[model samples]
Target: MNPTPPPTIVIVPGLRDHVADHWQTRLAQRLTAAGRAVHTVPPLTGERLALDAQVANLAATLTPLSGPVLLVAHSAGVITTVHWAARHSADVRGAILATPPDFETPLPDGYPTPAELAHHGWTPVPREPLAFPSIVAASADDPLGAPERVAAMARAWGSHLVDLGAVGHLNPASGHGDWPLAEELIATLESGPALAPIGATPTGEPG
Candidate 1:
């Protein structure tokens, strides 16, 4: 019999698991239904755990996959994943970071302020290029991060940027209960190292 396929999708939810009807949950379900094994690591509270602990958790989750893994992270989850990638890029195949809050910029309304999180030792994006291919998706109106800053982080990490027009944080509040675009991007990552340009609209074209 054929060996079980290595898990292709690893869903890293932020703070807590995606709420009911959240887009991330939908994306996970859809990918699993499409014959992809989805691994959802339990959420890490950035407040209670040290950054190193968070990174360790992420690394632990990655250790079991036998093949290239497509990492899907959102919100604060993006920061944790990027930090992990900076030090452990060889373990990850590629990543899709959606609505990564600007860790260097002051926080805006309805989000954690930089001052509030400064005590946690939040660091700026490292200057080194990520060891593998990656993508950063941000909204034109993401309250957590400005578009220009997100683009800069993408550049720093050597990742392609996707400017999702006016999609606030790309969360449940943003009305994205079914994020088909994200599913397609993760699928693309599983197939190869190259990714489409930032502004190229993804048509959910299945691989």
Candidate 2:
């Protein structure tokens, strides 16, 4: 009998352009070394329409994969994944959302301002629970989000919350280059429950 193949791992970075030392990039390298199929979504740091296009692009990328998919998204990428999953979650098995920022609040300097964020359709982020199993990892000291807000979002999304404990943003500035623990988190999704579209009722419920 043949061994079961690993699911395709999709690495998703925030709206900013890619950086060499970003932990997500480094994680992709490690996954590649382990012989797992990995694909990183290209940078899409433009306005709201660009974000929508990027989500569509993600769908195109996953369409051809032969196995289940596990999405790993960081920062603004978490919002992207959420928006994407709202439309195309049937292909996803599970996801790990790390250090998601509170889009309804102010963001860090150099990122889009509140007006720009709204202009780009970032305001009123989706609060609906995801269609598949997911985990939302948050840092106690993340500047882009408050612990309370993250927890609230997690509850709204029906995702398990993971306290990372004062790891500021979990980015390169936070000294998270080459995060070994991320692999452990990803491993948890390997045996996660099967995918079920959001709002899909179980048997005996009216449609």
Candidate 3:
């Protein structure tokens, strides 16, 4: 029998760690059931939590995983992953960024503006090609960012973009308790090209 593939799925949850029943949490469970090792980083909280600490934590998480590593990041977690990857390219094989909030855009009322985000040390994404392939998935109605902004980020990072229709923020609050589509997307990322658009039907085959 063929040996099982290396377990290298690193799941980075958003502002807070995914709660029970959240799609990201469910996806991590599913991957684990399939014999893949999954790591969920602790949530970054408090204004005092340094962004560099978060980046370092991510790097530490990636260190022991065998390659080619596949990174799965959601929301603000996407920013963390990208920032870490830009500096630690050798640690990652590819990435799937979901519903990334654009720091370049103006914030909504009661939200921090881009400058404020930067003031808090959330840096703008680097403008160089990533060491590995990456796919960015966004929704039509994400309150934190526009589709165009997400697409532009993908282009800048040399990644692929997928537009999920009207799926507000693609988070648990949006009623996406268990996103089977995201599982399919992960399977696709494991097999084929690094970047595939959203809504592209997978050809019949395991990744």
**Which candidate's TM-score is highest?**
2
TM-scores of all candidate predictions against the true structure: 0.84, 0.87, 0.85
Pull out the clashing pairs in model 1. none
| Candidate 3 residue spans exceeding 4 A from truth | 1-4, 45-49, 194-207
lDDT of 2 by residue, 53-96 (tens): 77876777777777788999999889888888777755677898
- Looking at model 1, residue 112 earns an lDDT score of 58
Is candidate 2 or 3 superior in lDDT?
Answer: 2
Clashes of 2: 0
In candidate 2, list every pair of residues with a backbone clash: none
Model 1, C-alpha of 139: deviation from truth (Å) = 0.5
Best by lDDT: 2
Would you list the clashing residue pairs of candidate 3?
Answer: 162-198
Give the per-residue Cα lDDT of candidate 1 at 27: 77
